[model samples]
Target: MSALFPALVAGSDRPALRLGADTLTYEELAEAAGALAVRIGGAGRVAVWATPTARTAVAVVAALLADVPAIPLNPRTGERELAHILGDSAPSVVLAGAEDVLPAGLAELPRIDVETTVTSFGPVPAAFAFAGGSDASESPALIVYTSGTTGPPKGVVLSSRAIAASLDALEEAWAWTADDVLVHALPLFHVHGLVLGVLGPLRRGGSVRHLGAFSTAGVARELGAGGGTMLFGVPTMYHRIADALADDPALVRALAEARLLVSGSAALPVHDHERITAATGRTVIERYGMTETLMNTSVPLGSHPRPGSVGLPLRGVELRLVEEDGTEMRAYDGESVGEIQVRGPNLFSAYLNRPDATAAAFDGDWFRTGDVAVREPDGYVRIVGRKATDLIKSGGYKIGAGEIENALLDHPAVREAAVTGAPDPDLGERIVAWVVPADAEKPPTAEELADHVAGLLAPHKRPRTVHFLRALPRNDMGKLLKKALPEALHG
Candidate 1:
């Protein structure tokens, strides 16, 4: 059995994690995780009250050290989703920080309060725990919950082998090393914020400084003041940074001096990309992945990343676009869009307690990503949108909502935009555009916007209906709440 955190377990005394004012060295983290691991040993599965705190990281590490699967419960999860997850995973114990006040649904679960301080060091005794119970590589490590359009959230069962493989591939892609200091204000729940933001640093023997809550000032202070090297953020955060860059010299300098800036979860508008690079002279690279698959492709470090593309597949990942009838599309043309299918070791094992759902998720060894994209002749993948939500079936033609959204965002009067297909009597579905106006006094007219789209894309891709909103509803990750928009329109 080998250790996942080889540096921490081997008693390297360098700084490992810093959340707000609290910092833990590798030895201190090892002691804290090792101590908690012994207490939580033998629990089949555990739940963590995932907050942006040092205790949250410790709890997750401790669970890994004990070879127990952990479910990260977002602290702000609503009662219905929370209850559904608790009933689904049936965790043997729920671990939270001393100050965490869980919701009513978590009251019935067995509780364990995690302490953030530890002094004992000098090598972890739990190194053997990394590969135990005879399952070693395939043993379940994390059960991350993901939402669907129809039902409650499903648990994505990520094994130790998958997580390790993903991180290792990213390590090579990003040129990540122990000398790098990662900084972010990402939550401890999702894969980008937690697995990549937190655990990725730990695995490479690097340091991660969590801001607890995101603020442009805090980011500038940390990054500009020589406190960090690499930075990870979503499009929302980067948008704010791009907005503030003209006036905030600290943030501008921070971007200019940073080793790398990565964006994920949702697509960053090409307009914002131009704004950031214009101000800081550094392009923010993007990557593509999902809860079911940890990471598939990334704009590798030291490369001139494309503004709108998600770049080539990482090492050991095989990606291909397939037609509607499951026929493989081999042409390297940049126009023909198809559903993306992937085969890699970085994929999650199964959905917890749902064999039928798990069976439907795969086509033999290839997991259908459900995301539609066009591949360039150079093999770079540029995602158009999701097949379920973003693919618009118009009159005799197929369109991608992401392209229209990007076009709408390009308009000077439009501040934000989302595109969806609504039911149409004449056509199978009509293109509907939801936009937030940059100037409410003189918002762009539907005809003007339709012409604008027609000028950019084909005439058929123009929106039939345009709805102006005060603001677009978005998740924490900056993903548009597409399903809720229609229900919200009628309300």
Candidate 2:
């Protein structure tokens, strides 16, 4: 029932954001957002498709305060996708970026030119005036969709309480302090960037050094110049930074200054972790999470950074490992592997308009994460494979892609790796690895990759084919899109 902006403004005036050439204090941001909220008056959903600019942040908060659902989409999505989303959400107002390319038919919709300034405005009706539903602790607030790399993305509904619980867990897990300065390079659409990168910092009265997109040199420069203490990024970003630092010793030193380095969204390979740690002297703290739950676990700060383990469950979160048949697996022991299930305050409420999927997402109160993982005796969980991609059956032997990809990444010649089961005649499926070489034209051959795996794996676990690709297709979060790799490699 509480408004986030009003709750945020109760304390003090401090710098909220530090974008290029612009710095917004909380007081200034609140005033601008409140004024804009008045201008947009009334209730109903408003889709915001803009970059991570100060104005976009203001507009999102304004929509929430105005008792309007804020649906923030990426400006780069295709016209068809945009049309589909617009038709589905049916927002009463659409606030687009000044340079955003909209679909052909948007000129007729009830839209407002967001770029235009709104100084004088009418007051928004009090919170009770809004009509659709009661603002309860469980009321759906934000709707973030999956990457849809394999299937049509489902929109996971999140409530304000859920978001707050996530922030609460992060505040303790990451040791986020008001003195922390977050260097954020991820986009705003996804949960990692929006919930963790932006909201995590804002809730703690910290500031973010926002970037338009991921840039190696630019990120290095920001790490050097800005007074940022923490950096959050995916494995791709870490790989790029490692490559950049190989050429410039100063960049390596600059990266070493961060007190905490977090990797999430996709699994961080063990080799990448060692390389990053060697170059920067900061052990990459890998966390486990999905769009459905912003963050659930993280590697403890002062503990030994295990290469493949995702540390432990965060505060206020409970975890369980379960079998395919909904039977809970024993986790206090050292040798049980099962689906990682979670039930916590931070978990998403449901999938938007997807009652069936939503119902299926939960087992009793625990949300069944499709990832297969193992919990060690020390309570650290290591993700072995994803049920959809990593669980590959070849020659009647099931394999985990994380194990294969981890093995491949350890090879001196391999810089990036993705493993998928390609169509086969006799074996039902065969393991295929698509790799990006460390040296541009000097990728390892199929025999070499197979031998590399053979030294570490059983014969059935070895990849049948090694495909040298320019780059593996990955989503914004750096998760491999195994579905797109076949078309890119073979075609």
Expressed as tens digits, the lDDT of each residue in 358-432 for candidate 1 is 898888899999999988899999898999999888897778888899998999899999999989999999999
Per-candidate TM vs. native? 0.97, 0.90
Worst lDDT run of 10 residues, candidate 2, spans: 127-136
lDDT of each: 0.87, 0.74
Query: How well is each residue in 1-491 modelled by candidate 2, as lDDT tens digits?
Result: 44443324542557777665567666666566667676675756677765777666767667656656677787667666667666766677777656665666466566665533344542333452232112235666666667665556677777767777888778888888888888868878788887788767766777877876778766667777776788889888887777677788767866788788888888888887887888877888999988898788998887887888888999988988887688988866544557888988888888777798889888888888899887888889888788877777788765677878989998999888888887789998899888888887777888888988989867787899888888888876677888888787876
Best by TM-score: 1
Name the lDDT value of residue 160 in candidate 2: 68
Q: What is residue 483's positional error in candidate 2, in angstroms?
A: 0.5
Candidate 1 CA-lDDT value: 0.87
lDDT of 2 at 205: 74
Superposed model 1: Cα runs more than 4 Å off: 120-122, 126-136
